[model samples]
Target: MTRAPWMAVIGLVACAAPAERSLTADPGAETTPVRPTHPSGIWPVTPPGADSPDTPDPPGSATNCDPLHLVATDIDETLTTDNDEWDLQIDDPSYDPAMRPDANTLLQGYAARGYTIAYVTARWDFEMSDGRLASEHTVDWLHDHGFPLHGGLVFLAPEPDHDGDEVVEYKSGVLLGLQAEGWALDWAYGNAETDIEAFLLAGFPDDSTFLVGDRAGELEVPGIPNEDAYTAHLAHLASVPDVRCE
Candidate 1:
């Protein structure tokens, strides 16, 4: 399938807030502009030059940026890449990415500006929040690194109650269920086509639900805010405009 490319500049509203934001807490204030990229300053890295290629624009001709909300990015692509995660979780007792360079700077920027930085994923479920072997294993793995997720909703392999048709339908129903429960969701970011299904369910009406990474022909919706999964995830965040936390 042909992927759509759309670019819509969302309006930015600057606001004041306390620094030293906590990753354990949810979003609290106005959204901030994208920060400068922080550098690990490793010699092996290639410093970006003046002749770098243009960042790819959004698809579907882009959507009008929502003034009230900012984009939500995928953890794998936007925060860290597959390779990096692999290294961290390479010898996982339960298989979780280390998430080095944590993207704390970026997340902090968003938090200071009041924009919600949600770490959306299909990793696990609410039932696993505590110490369930499955949940504990996944949570422990992510925590070992610095994922900076406030809360998470895990998807434990489709349900046995749903029929073939219902399986897809139910995966979506989960989001609606969360919202009905009063989860504070300003935006969403996730990987994969099924990941976007919730965007549609939640109403594909804002820039808050941006896509990151290269899924190629897997999706039809326009994912703005792209990033590299696992290995490149940190590098991509490093490529963000004005990122300076390091």
Candidate 2:
């Protein structure tokens, strides 16, 4: 697939309150064991240039960018059930994480059908615990568990101050950045009410958005049971024509 020309402008909105937002909670907000440095792995280290923030365009003028059909999903509860009651296990060493049931099947199915996958999580790029960048471990975790990595990219929150409710805006900006880079967000999945807010704020259609776990009904978006949503999503993708970015 041909890379779309990068637009000079991107649009972003201010953060909204939790109740007003579509998605909720920070996936990496909970405490976990911190490694002092990233573990070496076969996957190439994500370069620093890739972590730069996209410039936002003036209000009301942000353009819909990119021709690639993309599926953007959250990492914590939406894809991995590897967390505790509070849902924060990505940084833990003892989590013994496994992909949420059919997540692999669903994502791999999308890849096979030519859809690009985007893992958009609130996990910060800078580590708070040991001062190491978390992106490497995050990628290793995905690769270690066999999640589809070939045609996908991981979007991590660039800041360490996730204590505020900026997650809604942060996630929204990531989607908007992708749009600025010329990628069209076709589908999005998340467990928090804020996920719905971010996706909608970024202009995803209501029917194209899916909420996982119990928070699905909190917003007007359609709900898919956590256990079976992936399998069902794969079935839905069968009808979608393949789109390539390379």
Candidate 3:
């Protein structure tokens, strides 16, 4: 997950708004916002219009208190191999590639346990020069790899106005937005230092953040030498409780 020198240049154009498109399991499917639900014997649900966004509600409150058990993850080297030769242009013949070994399996395991998955990447929403939306291709890639594309799965990129910000800034904003919308981030995974920085900025505890590859973090898993560390991390996640899904 070493930062490529060219990434700085790409970052400038990468933060544009994503194309007006839907990436749900079915085309044209309407996105239903997740509602807060009470976890059995865990926390009581807060009354509607009773919680404030500016302050943290007690655990189980309708706003900013429900434990959604959401997991935010980065793409590229974290879930897929960082194949430098791959180019995402519409005409590029090498666009489709396999997910990192066991990546799908691990993700599916989380999905099976009722955790919501958010694919938050710094990749451009669309190629700025050509106006070709990379999000459509990204959706296809996730579908092709058998990752969950239905309920609770989301792909987030920088908004048009915020595209020029650093990856950490862009990602942190997205995470914060999700929190504001009542999504509780329980875990975050990334392969870059920026990922860790973003998660921390979004209020994820150091212990809940897992970093794969070379950069240091609270949990640094060896991503280059072998993927065993990632496998072990998945095993570790199995013990975590799945929050109420509503």
Task: Give RMSD to native, each candidate.
Answer: 16.1, 11.4, 11.5
Could you give candidate 2's per-residue lDDT for residues 1-246 as a string of tens digits? 211111111112222212111100123432222121111111223222231112342222212223656788888778876335212433453344556777877777776656667777777644425343456556656766667664366666655566435778877876786676667778888988778888999888888899887665668888887666576656776676565423
What TM-scores do the predictions have? 0.43, 0.66, 0.64
Tens-digit lDDT track for model 1 on 63-133? 11232233344444445555356335434433555342445554544443333333333332223323333
The true-versus-predicted C-alpha distance at residue 34 of model 1, in Å, is 40
Ranking of all candidate structures by their lDDT, best first = 2, 3, 1
* Per-residue alpha-carbon lDDT of candidate 3 for residues 1-246, written as tens digits (9 for 90 to 100): 111100111122223432222223233445333222211000111112322212343333222224555678887777776634234434573367546677777777776666667677776555634343565556557766877533333344444444323777877766776677567787777877778888888888777787776554334432332355455556775687755333
- Report residue 104 deviation for candidate 1 (angstroms): 5.2
Identify the candidate with maximal TM-score: 2
TM-score of 3: 0.64
In model 2, which range of ten residues has the least summed lDDT?
Answer: 2-11
Whole-model lDDT, model 2: 0.57
Task: Go through the candidates in order and give each one's C-alpha lDDT.
Answer: 0.36, 0.57, 0.53
- Best lDDT among the predictions, by candidate number: 2
**Residue clash pairs of candidate 3:** 15-163, 17-160
Q: To one decimal, what is the Cα RMSD in angstroms of model 1 from the true structure? A: 16.1
lDDT of 3 at 3: 11
Model 3 spans > 4 angstroms off: 1-66, 83-94, 127-132, 159-165, 216-225, 244-246
